[model samples]
Every structure is written in C-alpha cells, then in structure tokens.
Target: MGAEAILEKIRQNAEEEAAALRRQGEERAAAAAEKIRAEAAADAEALLESARRSAEELSRREDLMTGLEARKNALAARRAVVDEAFSEAHRMLLALPAERWEALISRLVLEASETGEEVLEVPASDREKYENGLLERLNAALERSGRKGKLTLAGAPGKMEGGFRLVGPVYDVDCSFEMLLSLVREENEREIARLLYPETRAAGE
Candidate 1:
C-alpha cells in the first residue's frame, strides 16, 4: 500500500484499539465492582453488629478502624481493574500482526518526526523490519507532506521494548508503548476510578 493508505490504516487501527480498551475496562470494572460492593456491604454490616456489642468508646473506635480498612481495600480492588485494562492493552499491542505493526510504528514515526530527518531508533528485535523498507516509506510520507524526507534508520537497536524514538539534533522524542500507555492511564485514571465505583463517587460529590 501507499504511504497515505498505510497511515489511514494506522488511524483506523488506533480507533479500534481505543474502543476495545474502553470495552475491556468497562467490562472488567462492571464484573469486579459488583462483587466488591456486596462483599464490602456484608463486611460493614458484620463489623457494625460486632461494634454494637462493645462499650461505647470501644465501639466508636472499632467502627472508625473498620470503615478505614474497608475503604482501603475497596480502593485497591478498583485500582486493580484499571491496571488490568492497561495490561491487556500492552498485550494486544505486542500481539499485533506484522502489517498492523508496521502501520502503527510508521504512523507514530511520521507524527513524531519534527524535521523529517531525524534518525529512527527502533527496538533491536525490529531492525530488519525497518531496514527492509519502513524507513523509505516513512521518508516518502514525510517528503510528500513537505518535510525534509531525509529520515534514516539507526544501525544500533533502541532500548524501548516496543515503539520507536526520533533522535533529533536538538531533542529526542519517546514513542515507546510503555510511555504511551502510561500517558493514557495518567490522563484517564480518575475517570476510570469513577466508572468502577460510581456510587462512591456520587456519594462523595
């Protein structure tokens, strides 16, 4: 396929991946949240019942302690759901087929290229992939877009497990899958937490 067509495929794949992530996160959260809610409610009831049998001061302390612990455990469980979603995303990205993988990294490289002449630093495992024709296609895309179009693939393998980096004279850009996914998680963490425990969020608000 042509450079533009590859880029378009990359965009479509990105949209699909994002949608899949949202669905996986929502499904996991929905599944785990209900179980946690019921368990927490039951535990709270049992704690309250036991507290009632204690002296007034002791009952108050017990209630406070148990409530704090319950909140801590609930928060932990919710965080786990968010963690699993990203883990699945990482898995899916790594598991992509060769064509899709080429499309993705190509798109990322094109976007990250500031001058279109930066050296492409790919994972050591993928050197042959880029050397084969990836760099030429990227340069073609860059030139077509009115950039320098002098991009070259690095001989040494990069440190990133997945994704590539653009090494420019002034600065470098990291487009590693790890950093990208972390950025996604950082931006949507609160929103994901709320989704997992909407009732708690609503009560707080």
Candidate 2:
C-alpha cells in the first residue's frame, strides 16, 4: 500500500478507538449515578421510618403521663371528701346533750380504768358534772369489776372538747372525743371508703 493510504487507515482506526472509549466512559458514569440514586432513596426511606417510630414513642409516653395525672387528681378529691365526712360526724357527736355526755363519760371511765386507781381528767368546761356523784358511780363500777383502786379527780382540769383521760401510774388512757374519732376512722378507713365511694368497688370489680 502507498504511504498516504496507510496513514489514512491509521487515522480511521484511531477515530473508532476514541468513539469506543467515549461510549464506555458514558456507560460507567450512568451506572455510578444510578447506584448513588438507589442509595439515596434507601437512606431517605430509613430516615422516614425512624422519625415515625420516634413520634409514636413520644405519643405513648404523653398518654401514660396524662393518665397518671388524672388518677392523682381523682385520689386527692376522694381524700378531701372522706375528710369532710369525718369532720361532720365529729361535730354531731360534740353537739350531744349534757345528760347524754354524762352517761357516756361514766361508761368511758369504767371501760378505760386499768387499776381503777387513776386520776380522772375531765374537760375544763364540764368539771361540775364530776363533782355530783359521778366519781361514786365510777368507783362502784370498778368494784363490780373486782378491781381494787380508788378513783379521784385530777386537780388540773383537762383541756379537751369532750371525753375523759385516765392518768394511770404507768400509762395514761385517752378516751377523748377527738382521739376516739381518730381511732375509729383509722380502724374503719377501708369500710368508710367503700361506703363513701361505691365507684372504687365498682372499678375493682
């Protein structure tokens, strides 16, 4: 072949090689771009899922907190109602007639006397009742119970609303109205709650 023909052939071969290289590069770039897009889509989906889970968890916690707060408020209200009921009962007991109180006092003294020789501390407001044969009746009751102890009135009047305190040699017995009511309340708290709030039992059921 001639020199010019050979050169022309070489130029044609070079052009074909360059075209092949360009096509290969374009294909590689397209593949890389597609891979990046797929990875980005997967990352975006994962982020969205994480956000949804976080939101659900937060909502659940808020709901639990709200329920707890509601229960606390309800318990406080119930306690207030129970306290008010006990207060009213105390007032009624304190408003009893003088004769009724005298009878109650005699019974309480007899029940509270341990050795029968205890100083009976009466309320300062009702000291006259004890001076009028009340001590005699208490001693008679103690005699019937087969206990040997002389009962006497305390020189210092007791500070109380009602009821008496028997000051014994070793220990003192408090039969005061306030103390008695408190004892009764503590002992029968559950029963009182059931009576006052029927809904509590119903809820338990």
Q: Largest lDDT belongs to which candidate?
A: 1
Lowest-scoring 10 consecutive residues by lDDT in candidate 1?
A: 1-10
Task: Report, for all candidates in order, the number of backbone clashes.
Answer: 0, 0
Segments of candidate 2 deviating more than 4 angstroms:
1-77, 191-203
| Cand. 1 Cα-lDDT | 0.58
lDDT of 2 by residue, 1-205 (tens): 1222222222233222212222223464355335533433333332223223433344444446557676565445545545554565556556657776566666666655667788988888777877887778778888998876489999999987777777877656666767655543443445445533445666998
Clashing pairs in 1: none
Candidate that scores best on TM-score: 1
Q: For all the candidates, what are their Cα RMSDs to the real structure?
A: 15.2, 43.3
Query: Deviation in angstroms for 22 in model 2?
Result: 99
- What tens-digit string does per-residue lDDT give for candidate 1 at 110-179? 6666678788888988888777888788899989988999998887888988887778776566667775
